[model samples]
Target: MPAASASSARSNSALSGSRCHDRLRTFHERLQSGWRMSAPLELFSYWRSSAAYRVRIGLNIKALAYVTHPVHLVRDGGEQHAAAYAQLNPQQLVPTLRHGAVVVPQSLAILEYLEEAFPDSARLLPAAPFERARVRALAQAIACDVHPLNNLRVMQLLEREWQRDAAQRLHWTQHWMQQGFAALELQLANALHTASFCHGDTPGLADCVLIPQLYNARRFEVDLAPYPTLQRIEQACLALPAFDAARPEMQIDAVV
Candidate 1:
């Protein structure tokens, strides 16, 4: 093929990609408008679960109204294990989102869903591909590497299955939390992406994930002084009403 022909084809490909993005954005705008005209969304959540806390931030950031159906993870042998809630989420996890007939499970997936389903909401992802990837990598570094190993089930296993005492269990949690935060601190301490929040001036996915983990860190009595970058970011996030309102202590069913 001629060089001129190849150039023309490339131009056409770029145009096609731009058009597709515009159409998708238009669809999302319509969805957001429709949601505003409807009732509040329903979320199955446990106030103390970090994953659930993350979802609450996303919902508030989107400016989407939602009513929480408290799924006590501990009371009455864990309400999430009941037959009714299991039908919505077979995994028996907190933070399951219900919008109309569409049910979404998984915290990260639900965040992405809100972004796509309600583009008018606060932008959870940057328009640039590389920036979005970076933000996701930062968020996953905590959500996957840190939070999972330190969750309630893990603590329960340490007590019931392993017979580890409270002091030993606290040590176990502090170990993994420190390991994860040390690497994250290095990543954010001086990077260009570091700002008031996780990505840029606006709070997005990384902020959503990080704030919850910080809450967890304090809960386990992990010494946070070592990670100034994380602590600074958490302070910035908590200053915002959307994030402050989503905190575990602010929930209707928060335990004493």
Candidate 2:
């Protein structure tokens, strides 16, 4: 898909509405009228992208059935650059969610929205405001701190502008992963909130973010020996079907 210009991207919602046949519109109205069945939540995602992985896990936890529209991030210098995808996401980020005419871009916002809009399904965040905030903080620790620093674009910049070799790139990745894990491990190890998962006995939003980031750590051969708490929690998470289903290698578009 060619990247859509910002103007075109903004029009995706309207365009989607126009493209919907009468039955589709009726179907959506039925959904809006509080029909409980899963709607066709079209997710534009790259299998290996951790931000995208977060949303995948959320969807699985909510038990929502959605079609995966794989957006190859590395192919042809990024299919996200294509006009079609850019139209769906003006920012050209992966893991954009399409619910009827609504196009949600940010992963965290998408997760929260799904939890709110589909409350009967397994809740991702806690009901208490403070607890929700804490879960969001823990999730942001990984999403905002560890992730953005080592994202593909940042790594690309290191190689392009700083002339970093593969070894340098791996070092860069591991440095950030270890730094974040060090803090997270201690935090989780001490916090009474930590049960088998990050938030409580049941897996929540924090665990969703942590597990994927840890997956990335292992992917780059980042040493996990320093983060025993993270490892223990991750092992518990992997035992669940939801987390296992959301693994990158299990995605429909996962590269073999």
Candidate 3:
């Protein structure tokens, strides 16, 4: 090859590399400035969904600005079953968070991500390892053990497959909630860490998880008289603007 031709090829390659570096530097600068690359945070949510409600609380507590893309869970046989949303979250779940090019699914995972990504903002988990674990355990007691059993899919399955009536379904929800809340009431009522909120005076991850379940309990007319501790905590959490603003009724997509 001619020397000039080789020299021109090398120059073009160097130019391309330099452009890539510049683009990366710009992206980093935007992130550092708290500005997203192409867009701010976007949440694919269903207003009445407990999982989505949890994410909304976390985002509000952090005071992060985000846009909501409402995915109706019950309309037209559920919008989450669509191909577009499925690409974002193969689980076809609500509360799928999108930040720039990154996509995150699952409410707890999204909460943890927010805590890590925006460390300077309000914290969702405690600094101590043991405290974090304790909080997570409490959060999971509701999120994992209790909520899943009463999820929309579970109710649909019970109705479609097992021919469970509305009264039976109500019993199903109330029974699991009672069992879980009984254990949580004991744990929170006796734990030294319990204060105004689940872990301490300020609401954290567990509070976020707990409040949504409590909302469901009320919706199903679960006997709250048995769990005084939970009722107290729910009151404390609801008094806060973050928790209040994140309620299912406050959401734009909420149906009357």
* lDDT against true structure, model 2: 0.89
List the candidate 1 regions with Cα displacement exceeding 4 Å: 1-39
Candidates' TM-scores? 0.86, 0.86, 0.87
48: Cα error in model 3, Å: 0.6
lDDT of each: 0.91, 0.89, 0.93
Cα misplacement distance, residue 188 of candidate 2 (Å)? 0.8
lDDT by residue for model 3 over 69-161, one digit each (tens)? 999998899999999989989999888999887899999999998898788889999999999999999999999999999999999999999
Model 2: how far residue 164 lies from native, Å: 0.9
The RMSD of every model to the true structure, in order and in angstroms, is 6.0, 12.9, 6.7
User: Candidate 2's residue-wise lDDT over 47-137, tens digit each?
Assistant: 9999999998899999999989999988999999999988889999898999877789989989988887787899998888988888999
Clashes of 2: 8
Clash pairs detected, candidate 1? none
- Candidate 1 TM-score versus the reference: 0.86
